[model samples]
Target chain A: MVSAQPAGFGHDTRHELIRFENVSKTFELSDRTVRAVENVNLSVARGEFVVLVGPSGCGKSTLLNMAAGLFHPTSGEVYYNGSLVDGYNLKTGYMTQNDHLLPWRDVVGNISTPLEIRGLARGTREARVEQLIDLVGLQGFERSYPSQLSGGMRKRTALARLLAYDPETLLLDEPFAALDAQLRLNMQIELLRISRSLNKTILFVTHDLDEAVALSDRSVVFSPRPGHIRHIADTPLPRDRNLTTLRHDPLYTRMTAELWDLIMPTLQETRGEAS
Target chain B: MTNAEIGYAPASDEKVAEDRKRRMDKARQARTRERVKLNLIRLLMIGGFFALWEFASGRLIAPFFISAPSAIFRRLGGWIWSGDIFYHMGITATEACAGLLLGSVFGIVVGTILGRRPFLARLLDPIITTFYSLPKVALAPLFILWIGIGMDMKITFTAAIVFFLVFLNTYTGVRNVSRELISILYLMGANEMQVLRRVVLPSAITWVFAGLRISVPYSLIGAIVGELMASNKGLGALLVRAQGEFDTAGVFAALVAIMVLAVIFNTAVRLLERRLMPWKSAEQELEGAV
Candidate 1:
């Protein structure tokens, strides 16, 4: 198998950008305790696009939250760039299912939040914001509030806001699941383009097998509740790929089918439990 | 040539334009007729109310006790002509405004603090509720004893009344802020103060405005009750004095003045809300459409 390595890459051994060392998280509910994730060990390489796929309530989001330092693992530690993460992982940008855009702020204002927090100069911030607006195709909506934008447009604005901080790593949680199919495809393509150009390390969580196969260099499948890594598979598809024509690729089809096979039992188990 | 070829057939574009115009005209006429009917009914209802009040005053009810609408109007006119009504109005307005400003500031500050700190909010919940349950009017006599029978007593009473209402609403508003948004802000490297200013305050502002709207009338009620209990100034004092002298018309006139004051305060608060939250109007319109 030919290893698809871009030029001027693959020599550095310090590729571990984010690492979870025997991490586990448990939530204490009012009446009982729920073990969300159990003894999960995962590592994301620098500039690697990794996707986490699992059934509902599988602690996929919990794993990402641990990486972002929003939630501390109960027993073990999460490390970023070889440093223990005690508080918020400032080097990473996190996006959840909800856009979480400030409704009071206009598009530019929302996108410029991180810059303002960092106390960037007015001219520089405005210039960067304008560039992002163009990049996200939200040029004419600079002054429109979140309520005024369409669902797809709001998601784009959120992406722009996430990028504004220029974090080295991104933690995205089903960011495109709320969008319709066409819009979702468009966003996925845009995300891939941006991720490549920026060369960001991404740990994305999604329930869609096709999305995972299409976007990631390595896809991690998680088991249902008390989530553990069930399988970690490397995509055979080349890095230079077109998202629109991805499904037609034989290799892409096989990868998605394999993922579906791996996740179907857990999905059925959940259905069984519900019934 | 056939008749169709000789241009005797109706022109399609002209006919369509004429039909559209006729439909629009009919719609406009119907709207105008409906509006006229509505206004006529409203006027008749108001006229009928006054006529009945006049008819019942001296026959079914005693004029000396209930007083006639004409007599109340005459008393009001006399006060206005003498310019004594303005003095009473000025005093009441001052007390209410002072109390509202002070109460709102205190409420927002304390409410925000308590809202941000769940432990503190929970700790004080029982005590706060106990105080909140106490009728604010009952405090008027206590305020008079402490502050003495002047504008200070009325202002203090009004502030106490307005404070509790505003505080509860602001607290709920802050608590109800979106957890997702707060988490996002924290991930963005915002400290506690930044999160409060940039996210929490803005998110809770609508609830704060709602509280402000509700507190305006309560502020007036507090001031008037304080004055009625014991004061030498304000419209409430005037009403008390009129009752003592058996001037039923003067008492009715004072009540009318208080109603006008409520309307004015409500209008001012609405204007302030519009100015502060321009985004809320768009949000409301979206909600209305949905």
Candidate 2:
């Protein structure tokens, strides 16, 4: 990683990058209306790592989609940098479970895609792509296509691509959900190291409570369907703390237990309704 | 590791390399044997069919109905020596290639625009369907009436036949490009043009190439049939001429020439496919329908 300089993109004294004000989303399917999320109000500050945690189909992902401006809130507004995200907020980089790393392109081409889109000078774009390739530890696999690479390697390519253009915020939807346990842990640690050093505001959506505890400045736990905030707990773990040893920390265990208690009742209640 | 580290022995590593090479050589030999067996089977089938036909040509069945392979090859050789087959072949190839290239360009451009704009796609859907439903041979009389019996008329007919196929395939391909991929680009500060260039076109190109491969034989059919109907220049005209003279061997030779030409055109397309889409193998391309 070429030493990340936050001064390059020019962030002033403003703190808030994303703010969801009473945001509610209702999806109109063919047979039924799906109220994905209801009245979710949360603000993510600049350089903050916020993880949205919940059970599956709990609309945590819907909120991330809202922040990315893929879809608007049906009721209230979602804002970025004090402006309403009317359509396709161009300031964010999004990565989902599937790498979407264009099977046609090799790794270098995929990472350099955003830079090419922005029409950066060829030499500068090449240099940045080179730096990103190193950042994601994909140096030797630069010429390898996504289909040829392993799952973990493809995810790394996608991450390198997301960082190539240097978006102010990253919207990740369980980006490592498909990986094996050890690979997922390694990716999590690497992501934390990069995002922390680069000062990226990340809103990561995950169903795993352990992951939420491991990688966030604050954890916003959501209820079951028609998800709204169940609790917003500040992790307050040291940024430089080693994740491999962090589970031993009493604060980490206590917070995980507390968040678990908050989520269990909602899960049981939903299951009871289903039964 | 202890012995190698202490004494800097290269023998163990050399032995590992030799074992790997031997395994690779055995696999290569197996692959070659399989391919040779397949080719031998193909050869046997083709040769057996031809030998049976040759034996029956004059003895059981009348040679006039189904000429012997030897007689057909002799006629083909004479035509080659006289240099008439080359003329017909050149004219047919030119018309087919010209029509294919022109039709594909129009199909890709039109299909892309309509695929991107659903409103326009819907507005013109009925007319496009009607055009597609119309038969290629039926339009020959009208094409002759409009442009007359030159090479242009044949090329136009071929292009028209090719346009609809290429257009439909390209339209379906472009429409089915992953929404997630497009949205990701949009979020990455890509404009509509950038998104199309970066994602839509590349994604849809596999479809475009499929259409092109399908259009190759159809283009040849278009030119040959048009020549058969009116023109004096192509292999189709040579077939018509042989039929008029009641020369069974000549007709058989011309048919064989057409078959060879078809094979050549198809091979060209496969080669071009390999060049254009290095990322995908021929079999791998047929996936991603959704």
Candidate 3:
């Protein structure tokens, strides 16, 4: 029944921001079909930081796409704010793996793109873009093109651009996958800071175990291939989280090991099936 | 609000910055000197070629068969002195300009439309390829027959040639546009028209400029070919008349004029390219390429 929602069977429907109604997506190719995700029943409550953790090819990104209204479930429905998401959802901002920053645009221009698209006044757009640039610490790099920016700087610019339109929710799909370890760690810290300051609902997708455990209020662990929500575990880490120090915390280490235990079997099963 | 709030790169050794500037200056000066030397060598090579041609025209070969550069220069001078070249050049330039504008618009539009519709493009690909393969010059006679041997025929023929050159370039541009970029914008609640303007147009314009660079010269050539095939007013007609009279120098002079026309068209396109795609750094552009 529609009332029987995951983690919220008795809770009021008003608090639920997004709900997946028995969602399944089967992508048909010329010769075969790829069942990307199956029977994905989930509910993201308002202001909840839900991180989807899975191995590559697990359709974690597809779930994010479904939430953003880029794709519809082949079998079921995706409801956002009590309405079916039939088209591109305006309430969410998606930061894809690729920065997707317009190469022709400088830092300022790329940050101001969403505002410009929304047809905001020139002065208002400029003021907002300036504020975002400052927020993301891209002050001196305003004139620099994406090509001229460092990898870390480019990711920061993307973060600012995502914040430019001021969406209520953020769907970040493998946003820091390409960054080096140090940069990735720094961005993870930056994301936590930004997400806290803005209090935005974030549906973060990453394969990285540490990232999932470090950032999420509730970490949704997924199995390989046809992605199934294997475990929905609460992170229960302190709100004032410093990742550098938190990585060594007793709870952080234990959560990560538990997540790996849940994930390790799927990897072995995939290998078994392949062989 | 303050820089101290975020991680800083720290002062990157002022001496390193100064040294970098100095090396850049030296490199620029070295490049300037090399260019000067290159120009000097080119001048010598051209002068030697002319000297050989001048001597050989009368001594080793018949001046009738191979007109001297001096004779071509005289013919050009005569055209310049009489101001008769203005008449022919003005017509040719007009045809080329008209053709460029009309063809570029059609090319950009058709190419962009095709780019957005994958199935429609796939259905039309075979016919489109066939048309693209059809040599544009082969259409001159048909265009002349249909439109008649006037400015109309020349302009139409020129536009036909330009369309293909620009069409493929823009189509390729549209194809290469990042789909993820469009998806990102769509997620931001940008409409189809806004996506077209913000993502598609900017991505395709770079290719349009490339197409224009290649198309500008062809546009002029198309006009000239049309004129040569029929028309009695343009510079192509002048070349034909010279050939009829066995005026080798006149033929050479006409060719020289066409080269000059091509240079002018290319320079104009370059200027326009500078204006439209200012994001493309001039230093990143090929130093002396068309």
Candidate 4:
């Protein structure tokens, strides 16, 4: 099936990027039980940019984190390319909400960290690092430490780090939630462009509806806190999607409105509204 | 704003900017190299101090109580050549090395276990802290009595001193690990052993190394104290015998030997730490910014 996809399948009909098979997660907090995610079943295809969007405290981040191997479901399995994920395989790169850059490393060194961990030769690592640094528009900031870089620059460096290792899949858990509005917009566009160009599968988590619409092939709207899957809305945006045109599309508005309606009731329920 | 108004200048302008950047980068590299050179110079200054002290004592001042550097070197050279220095150094080294190995091993294993397991951490918290806080050096006489006037006494003394430092550092390391990081490792399919080896050990190594660096000097002190009280062959015993006979120069020479050995050992440990922890710099930089 995997070999057939590369040779015969249409670009959109490529093999599933990741599959969550009957996943459930539970937590025992001081004898007080909490069911975090209940029976989530979904499959994301190769090169698809999927966003798990919901209000804060929902299991959106948890779902994305599970895909990153940062959290395991209490039951069921997560399969990548039809193989079960049992441990951190390093094949999928994860970007955390807070940019977890090692402060002592310079921008180029930070980007090349996974290569260092994999024990790549210095000469090859340096060449790859330079390529990533330039791709992220951090060419001049190679020697600068994370401490010296602005928040936006740090995030950019982190993104470069994610791309440096050429992971087939990328999982982002509210990666740009800490950025200001303008920077977030810029980053979202860059991220989308990079994802499409690299043809990498991405599972991005966010609470912002506009961001989900802006970047995702499909946006999965989740229920509020201790979430269940509410709806998965697919956008007919092309692989070469653009921000300027997305806002102009009537279809974008229609899908966003549908997802917003799904989220509104859940938000009201969490807020204990009489309605 | 228009693209031109946003100052999307020609590629040549950007290339010029890049050239300036290259120069600045070279300057920064040079500065870092200079800083390392300065640290080496400071090390040489310390050596220079001992040389001046030896020359002034032997030539200018009376050499009765103060030993000349040359004289001390000559004595050290004879001792080394004839293997007498090795005998004394070997005794103290054996005690210190054994005690350090046993104590650090016990501390890391026990400390990490207790730190990770909440029930155990809570159960032993008070008792562990109390014993750790108490100065074990003062109990050297008691240890000598317990283990008899042999190498056992020195080993026990060194072990007692080393244990608490390593235990506290390792405990702090395990306890301070990022909760989010652990969850990430688990989600990655890391089992208990993998988590310990990949996550816990690496996370705790900085603290364990810190503890090791601190406890090594204490190990030396503990062994010396044990020798002073009862041992017949270690460096401490040599110093005691020299002092009893009013051979102050001999005592000073012994003290100099210990200092040189200590400095060498400490330097080697620091070099080992640098090789092991390539990740440490990033963490430090993050902290500095915070």
Candidate 5:
């Protein structure tokens, strides 16, 4: 059960970093109105990794955008640290599905952009960039431009850049969706390790049920367009779970199965419409 | 064992080495032959063109108007021998280069300002369109009347022509930057100026270079047309003088000089593009392949 916290105050302010209080979003096009999400209430605790899985066009990304302060909810409010997020939230970093790496800059240049914006000293920036490059397994590609990099390598650069300014929370929208299966698994493992080590809160959006189970402390499933939360299940796996061995864990399997079962009819309806 | 004894054993490394060497030699020979064939065809084409021109000038048309290629080359050689062409060339070059530099700098500054201020850009869109629609070359005479029949008029006209071309491209380039990228930067705590410097400017540079590349010939045309209308010096003046005297060879010589200058200017911009935006070139190649 989710409790409706007050707009300005929460009982446990220390743990709850991001709160959506009955948030809804609608787009008013020229001829029609599209209700993207409806009356969704959720809270992400400090250092918690939460994933949202739903059917296509189910407004998972919209939810993340609201948390990032890039979009305002139609009716309710999104709160960050017990304050209404009215403008751009500086405490969080957003990584979209597209790498959005500055095409003109090389890997090191792109990764160090946030530091440069903050006017960090040259030496310190270089050192931090070097560490991130090493962390992302992009040591040899520091001087290579984004256009020259493969999809997975570009994703790694994006991840490094997102971590550059050390935002307390990460808002990622299917960052690894473009990667191959093996690379996706590797990135997931790396992400889990990094999140645990840094203790950063993360709100991830993905359509993949298995990824939701493998990456998140809790998985939230939603119905199709005008999306609302259908089920919220905590992963039964341990905190230090390995991505490679997650499929074999009974809890991971059961959690993914439960999520799939909840969203199956929506997915089939979308598929039927497409066909 | 019996088959090996009858010379059916595995081949020695020396035989494989010989085969590889022969293949490489054959490939080299083929490449040389291809180069020679291409060169020969090019030579034939040029020679045939000149021979045909010579025949047609005397038979099909008046030799007075369409001077033969030999006469054109002779006039070109005479200009080189006398050194008068250099002075005229230097004047035109100064006008074109100065106008190009000044106009590009001005265009980039104004375009960037307008691009960042969407309110101003929308307000002035119609006025900008009207100015752009006015025949720029037709204003050369007006510039001559205001600035006098000197190099100043030509330079100003050239700069005016280059300005519009670069401005529109730079503005579009800035406006075309992805909204998603801007939002990401904002979430990263980038203020307006930081966003402009780190994202908008660098992203617009490729378009700026493209505009520069296209403006080279227009800049030359602007200068030459201004000179032809009323100027004491420049290749365009030389052409006008030759036309008045009915020296077709001199006219051809001046035209050829302009062509050569255009080629040099184009090559310089291309080289600068390669050096300055190496990433863009690589990106273009990837897009081409896709």
Candidate 6:
């Protein structure tokens, strides 16, 4: 909503932030053993928007979860900042599909939860939480509970919560998948603007090819279950590009279409190769 | 598609959506009304039964085995005014209250210690459950022998009843908390105590409330049963004395007093629950009034 520098955000320079070295995950169910991810070697760079796209049960989410330190890899190591992640840390903020805001907490309280967890002084935390409320365009509804807000508003509140801690890296799990088509586009534009201003590294998981191309600097496509990389594509779109200019980019359509094509074959292959 | 053709489909979709929403609203209203009606009927039925008891004992039936509601009230009034009921009520209340508080504290501490440590939970779960399952009434003689037949026996019995119910419920509640919620909190830089304080405790509140509701009744039952086994002053002792002397009216009166105490305690606890959980009402509504 406010003007910010655009040129400085567009650089394609990469710095290694997180690296996955031959990571694999296996889950044991009552009657079956499922390998959710398999030898997935991937790395996310600082200040880069990395989107992981695939179909259902693609292990894309599993791979992301491992990177988030939600699950331990069965075989390999995930190094963040050149060190293996031991347990959960505040340095990486994860926003799940469901906005896990406590019902008892109002918008301001929810947004400041990370700060509260860190045990920041009440006065400083309150001031920063108010700033976040304004930053997210949620000024008037600071006192509203999650139940009282609309779908888009709740997502914004959750995003605000993620941003309040100002984590070095952000992990999003299909954050806008629940919104309507029009609202999803609006949110995409807003997310780009915020991400640009913050210059934070983000790893986003999504099913929509258009979303991946429109939002991410590079897209990693996963194969099927026990997911491995099918292909990785880099988009030429600038970091400051919003939904309007992103859709109008000459290379945008081709990038999205190519990703769709790459993923479609895997979907079909997985189905056929299964029972 | 032209605007004219597209227009009708969208319009119909909107109307259908609106109709469904209206129907849903009506259904919610109907359900709320039914809940209110059920509560009112329950209250009226209780009152009506009391009135019928008064009428039967006073007029048609002989007031021998079953005392009239009016007679019980008059007897209660005399006992209270003459300060005779006060000592007995005080003894039972003190034993029940003391036992409940101490037992609940121990139960929560033990339950929490076991719940967080999975290996410990596994090792001690069977033993704890076995103790819980053993007939509580059978423990009365053991408690009497150990505590020597005074208020200590009553308190021990009450404690025994309150402890297991609370321990089992709290243990399950702690176990039932979502692992994801814990991880999220941990990632937010919460320490172990904070995770337990903010996440586990709040998640367990509803179950703890349920356990409290159940244990309060057990507290009263335990005290009364202990008194029945051996006590000189309590409603249970009064009932035993009345039965030995064939004072059926006195027995009925003592039972009625116990029921009244239970109803009052439950009502107070329900009020406390409502105060503690203002968020639960909104959450339930979002779950579609079910």
Scored by TM-score, the top model is 2
Candidates' C-alpha lDDT:
0.85, 0.84, 0.83, 0.75, 0.85, 0.78
Where does model 3 exceed 4 Å of error? A1-14, A269-275, B1-40, B118-135, B138-147, B282-290
> Per-residue alpha-carbon lDDT of model 2 for B1-290, expressed as tens digits?
12222232233323543454465566667778999999999999999999999999999999989989999999999999999999999999899988898888899999999999999999999999988888989999999999999999999999998998899889999999999999998888888999898899989988998898899889999999999999887899999999999999999999999999999999998988788776785224323311
lDDT of 1 by residue, A1-275 (tens): 02212121222336888887778899999999988987777778899898989988889999888888889999988888989998788888888888889999999999999999888999999999999987776766788778767777788899999999988999999999998786687678778878888899999999899999999998988888888778878888988788777878999999999999989998998788678
Q: Candidate 2 lDDT, tens digit per residue, A1-275?
A: 12211121222235888888878899999999999998777888889898988877889889989998899899999989989998898889899998898878888999989889888999999999998876666666777667556677788889889888789899999999997776676678778877888898999998888899999988887888888877788886887767777789999999899889988988897887678
Clashing pairs in 1: none
TM-score of each: 0.89, 0.91, 0.89, 0.65, 0.89, 0.88
**Native-to-model Cα distance after best TM-score fit, residue B270 in candidate 5, in Å:** 0.9
Residue pairs clashing, model 3: none
Global lDDT of model 1? 0.85
Candidate 5 docking quality: incorrect, acceptable, medium or high: acceptable
* Candidate whose DockQ is highest: 3
Per-residue lDDT of B1-290 in model 1, one digit per residue for the tens? 22233232223323433454465566667778999999999999999998999899999999888898999999999999999999998999999999998898899999999999999999999999999999988887787778798898888888998899889989999999998788888888889988999899999999998999999999899888888888878999999999999999889999999999999999999999988887776575454232
lDDT of 3: 0.83
Model 6 over residues A195-250: C-alpha lDDT tens digits? 77788888899988999999999888887886777677888776656575566777
Give a tens-digit lDDT track for model 6, residues B1-290.
Answer: 12232121223323433454565577679889999999999999999999888888848887886877777778778777888677777788788888888788877877777778889999987887798789999999998778799998888889988988888888888998878778777777789898898778777778877888999889998988988888888878877987898766667767777787788778877888778776665455445522
Candidate 6, lDDT over the whole model: 0.78
* CAPRI accuracy category, model 6: acceptable
Residue A272 Cα positional deviation in candidate 6, in Å, after optimal superposition? 3.5
Please give the DockQ score of every candidate, comma-separated: 0.25, 0.36, 0.39, 0.11, 0.30, 0.26
Candidate 1 Cα outliers beyond 4 Å, as residue runs: A1-13, B1-44
| Native contact fraction (fnat) of model 6 | 0.38
Q: Would you list the rank order by DockQ, best first?
A: 3, 2, 5, 6, 1, 4
Pairs clashing in candidate 2? none
True interface contacts reproduced by each model, as a fraction? 0.53, 0.62, 0.53, 0.10, 0.64, 0.38
What tens digits encode model 3's per-residue C-alpha lDDT throughout A119-188? 9999999999988877766767788767656566778899999988889899999899887776676677
RMSD values, in order shown: 9.0, 7.0, 4.1, 9.0, 8.4, 6.8
CAPRI quality band, candidate 1: acceptable
